[model samples]
Target: RTVYVNGAYLPETEATISIFDRGFLMADAVYEVTSVLDGKLIDFEGHAVRLQRSLDELEMAAPCTQEELLEIHRKLVELNDIDEGLVYLQVTRGSDGDRDFVFPSADTKPSLVLFTQNKPGLADNPAAKKGAKIISIEDIRWGRRDIKTVQLLYPSMGKMMAKKAGCDDAWMVEDGYVTEGTSNNAYFVKDGVIVTRPLSNDILHGITRKAVLRMAAEAQLKIEERLFTIEEAQAADEAFTTSASAFVMPVVEIDGVALGDGTPGPIASRLREIYLDESR
Candidate 1:
């Protein structure tokens, strides 16, 4: 596999960063993941725009222009022979050759890294058919989850928690309401109305969420942007989530309670179909 580090494309083993890199030392970085389908990038522009926003929120400068980023993504996809999968990109405050509490000067360049993960038939994941069972965990993450930074220790722990609970993934709850899935945005449907948390500093502004919701609305599915508690979601007729990787996936159960006969509901399934149909 080939990977990009700094400005050079090299073999995976050849790509390297300094141990003093701020992203590794202090988690001072932002990243984006764009899914690939049919040898093309899906929603690359949206990810790039969000990447810039995340960098801006942290007062960090972009490592390269959006056009350059796109070319890099294409090059890596081609070089890695990625027909179906995703691209991951990271930008971090570069090493200053010394560790200090203070940030380096603007002259210090930010480190940029890009790689491709090749997964065939990702859009046809069989798990989406059976739907998914998820457990709820406390949202212990920092306040600015809206920023797409690389501080993901808590989310990683949530995945482990889900694994231990015999579930596919975990939804994070704050103040009795679901914030999001550990790595994706959360949503549920009630009486044909789609309900999800509104965008704010509390939750990520999911790129797939934006696209799916728009498509749902255009499909004449009723939509609502408001907080819903775990109890409410458990009672919802249908539930699901959206992400660059997962697209739209059904949530059949929450906290040991099965939703609507524990089968993937029509709305969730339809949205997934619509998402896949349009995205590709």
Candidate 2:
């Protein structure tokens, strides 16, 4: 695979970053992932907008313009021949020759890097058909989740916890309500109404979440942007998650409790279909 590093495109093995970089040393970085289907980038503009928002929230400067970023994505997709995959972009505060707890000088430039992952048939992932089972874990992440930083240790640990428990992923709970899945925005349905937590610093404000909610509303599906507890989700008619990678994935069970008949429900299936169709 080919990768981008400091304005240079190179083979994956050749790309490198400084060991003292702030992003590596202090987790001072923001990132975005844009999926590609049929060789066309999906929701590039949305990701671009969110990327800027994350940077702005961190008091960081853009390494390049949005248009330039789009062009780089296009170039990498072409170079890698990626038809169904994702473009991952990251920007971090550049480093000085010496490491310090204090912020670097304002003259320091930010480092920009991007790469493509070829996931062949990513949209048609079979896991979406069989559905997923999720276990709930405590939300111990830092509070600034609204910023898409590269600090994913907690989420990665949650995924491991789910795997050890024989589930697909983990829903993070905080203050008596389900915050979100380890890597995606969580949702559930009851009486044909889709319910999810309202946007806040507690969650990442997923780009895919915004698009799916809009499409659901356009199809006249009722939505309730309020918090729901894990017990409530266990009794929900159905459950699912949305992310750049998994678009809309049905959740058949929660903490060993089966939702409905322990299968993907019609509402989740239909929304996934509509999302794929409209997004393409």
Identify the runs in model 1 with alpha carbons over 4 angstroms from their true place: none
lDDT of 2 by residue, 179-269 (tens): 9998899999999999999999999999899999999999999999998999999989999999999899999999999999999999999
Query: Which residue runs of candidate 2 sit more than 4 Å off their true CA positions?
Result: none
State the C-alpha lDDT per candidate: 0.94, 0.94
Residue-wise lDDT of candidate 1 within 161-268, one digit each (tens)?
998999999999999889999999999999999999999999999999999989998998899999989999998998999999999999999999999999999999
Pairs that clash in candidate 2: none
lDDT at position 5, candidate 2: 94
Q: Worst 10-residue stretch by lDDT in candidate 2?
A: 94-103
Q: What is the lDDT of residue 72 in candidate 2?
A: 98
Write down the TM-score of every candidate: 0.99, 0.99
